[model samples]
Target chain A: MSRSQQLYEAMILDHNKKPRNFSVMDPHTHSSHGKNPLCGDDFYVYISCNDTEIEAISFIGQGCAISKSSGSMMTEMLKGLPIQEALELKESFLEMVSTDISPEKKKSLGKLKVFEGVKDFPARVKCAALVWRALEDALGAKSGETSTE
Target chain B: MLNPNIRKQFPVLKHIENGHELVYLDNTATTHKPLRVIERMTKFYTHQNATVHRGVYGLSQSATDYCEEARKKVQTFIKAKHEEEIIFVKGTTEAINLVAESFGRFHLKKGQEILITEMEHHANIVPWQQLCIKHGCTLQVAPIKDNGELNLEAWKAGINKNTGLVAFTHVSNALGTTNPVQEMCDFAKAAGVAVLIDGAQAMSHIEVDVQALNCDFYAFSAHKMHGPTGIGVLYGKHELLKIMPPYQTGGDMIDVVTFEKTTFAVPPARFEPGTPAIAEIIGLGETIDFLTEIGLNNIFHHEHTLLNYANIKLKEIKGLRIIGEAKEKNAIVSFVLDDIHPHDAGTILDTEGIAVRVGHHCAQPLMKRLEVPATIRASFSMYNTLEEVDKLVAGIKKIQGIML
Candidate 1:
């Protein structure tokens, strides 16, 4: 596939159209804001933790399809995983999107492999990782702002 | 009105993108450089590359002459009285900052005012804002009408005895509103307020006669006019520039050096502190000559036709709402589609090899006033054909089909 087609795939567009886990968790245990100031993309990732496992994960914000779809997919994949596991997932996702991770590691990313196309387009890397960055910050900190600049 | 010959001069126009012909409509951001400009720059670097003004050798003299000749070309193009009135800076942002620091801080006292329009780019607004914060002065913004036209009465009402300077854009970069700069300058002059016209968007699109406008300062960039980037011109009245202190003190700008204190050079040299963009300036001069040969009147006429064609074509698309509809606008058309954010639309447009700009366009306040986060802007140039406008329209329709 061409770079543009890979970046804006059919599944990604569907995810953008009807994003899953896109809401504000009222009694959220952890939440953090992610913003890309240059592109004016802003999102707030919310998570409810039960012990170490994630009871729920969701996001609410405005951005391009790449970011919105990635956010939707991120929340979909991270739920039911331990906070540490989610953090580990974030590291692998960032690595895979930015570099040539081995096929074994790429298989580990699962549905998040859709974002591997971002590696070819440098500018869209921030768009794809904004949600993951927010997820990492939400898992790591009590509450703060995470910016992909 | 579209000149096929003119379009042929720009080599980039011949290329295709994404299995489709490239439809470049983002002229306001920066124009595609003509072969003349590119060739001139290449020739300068290949043959006559040297540091200007300081070299006593023959090569240095030639480079200095090239730079000065470019300045003279600019002076003639803008119809400034003297070549020395033109000072070289990085771009419009640096030009405004230079005035804000040197003239603004030096002249305006505490509790005084610097007035600007709501339609100005961030470049024209921020420098004065910084000045206002540092000097305990006030920054006033004249509001734009709902139609995106500058409210002349409101702008005039903002000016008073306390208003030290009036800084406004000749043509708004966001909305293509061609401001009544001559009238505003006259009113400001009557009020004893100095006027500075930000001509970043105007110089390429229209004939800029600084003498006829009679403004204290005029500033624009070279890249926006098909010249190379990192070079700009700031044309200030000699009388005012002489009295205003040097913006930056450095090696080339010093008249005399002593342990006690160093004296500064006069006017243009005083303002230009260090090494300037010599090759880019020469390229700018060539670009100016190329445009002059085409005639600004002919270019304006061609672009007007393109704007009208694009405006009608874009309006035909359902759910598309144009942002600015000023009666006297240039070739910019900013619009938003229903439910689809500009970024999404821009992405879809790119698939069809159509280029446009989508953002707040560095006019966040104007965006706030317009009640939208951002808009899709398709700005035209002289070389843009009516066929390109059709491509843009078709691209938007495809975006609507996908997103809406």
Candidate 2:
């Protein structure tokens, strides 16, 4: 596949076109805005956690396929998962885009592994990591606008 | 017409990587330096390096002469009447800041207004906003039409009894819309208001005559016109510079010093302080020679042809919408391809070794006026060719096929 194709895989495109959980979670417990000023990518991630588990997660914004699709896949993975496991996934997801990940770690990422191609395009790294950064902030003790500058 | 051989002067046009020749389309952001400029800068560093103005040594005298000679070139390039009107700055941003801090403090009063247009780059916008906050002044904006043209009536009306100063860009870096500078200056003159033009985009693409425009202040960067980076200029009428306070205080700008009191120097020296960017100013001197040898009118015509051709060809593509359709624009074309985001298009284009800018272009207010979150900008210069623009069109089509 071409390098462009690698970044925009069919699965990623599908997620981008019909983004899952692409909405505002009403009565949400946590919400954070993410923006990449260089690329003009802006998004808001919403999460509703009950006790120790995330009951719902959603996102809505305007951005490139890499950012929107990554947000969509993240919501799909974190829904119904324990908060600890979701945080672990976020850490691994950030790593997968930034550096080379082993096959074992790559297999653990599942559909999120599509972003491993992001390591090749340094400019687009922030695009793929925007929502993840927002999610990390939303899931943590802090909540505000996050910038992947 | 510009000689097509001008392309040979820029070495970056020959750049090849990943088995693809690079197609540079971001001239509005900055242009690549020519061989003469680079060579002259090397010569300055190698043999002519010394502190300017303060040194009594022979080498330092030669360096001061070269630097001052460059100042003369700038004064002549923009048709300023006196060399003392020219102030060496870091770049366009710093130039604007210097005026906003220095001129604003000296001239403007509380509740007085600073009027600017909707299409200004952030470099021109933020400093005034900060000035308003700092000095209890009011900031007002002139409107632009849906076609990205400045609304002349609104702009003329915007300068009223309360308006102290007006600032606008000569050629918009994002929209490619050239303002009616002389007409705008005439309006400000009729209103008895001062004006400062952001000429960063105009320095390379247009023949700028500050005297002809009759504007009080003009600011621009050297790198935008193939000079070295880290150097820029602010051209203020000498009378204003003489009255206005110094922006920074240090060695070169000082005239006298005492234990308790110190006095400053004259116009240009008063504005410029500390050690200057010596080699870059020397490079700017060579950049002026390079541009003048090719001729600004000829370069304007060559880039005009490229803009017209690219506009016609790109508009023919399906789902491509061109933005900023100003009648007086030059050297830039901004557009959106289908529903595909500009960032995605930019990345795919980079894969083909094409460099284009895709974003709000430091003109978020202009973007809001144009109703686009972002856009893909293809800016041309004298060195660019029609064939390179063809590559840009093909790259856009490829992006649509892959992305849409």
Q: What is the C-alpha RMSD of each candidate to the true structure, in Å?
A: 1.9, 1.1
Candidate 2 per-residue C-alpha lDDT over B1-404 given as tens digits, one digit per residue, 9 for 90 to 100 = 46678878888889984458989999999899999899999998898888888567998999999999999999999999999999899999999999999999879999999999999999999999999999999999999998889999999988889999999999988889999999999989889999999999999678999998999999999999999999999999988888998888988888898879889999788888888999999899999998998888888899999999999999999999989899999879999977799999999998888999999999998888888999999999888889898999899988988887
Clashes of each: 0, 0
Clashing pairs in 1: none
Predicted structure with the largest lDDT when compared to the true one = 2
TM-score of candidate 1 to 2 decimals? 0.95
Give the top-scoring candidate (TM-score). 2
* Candidate 1 CAPRI assessment class: acceptable
- DockQ for every model comes to 0.40, 0.85
Error of 2 at B119 (Å): 0.2
* Cα lDDT, all candidates: 0.89, 0.91
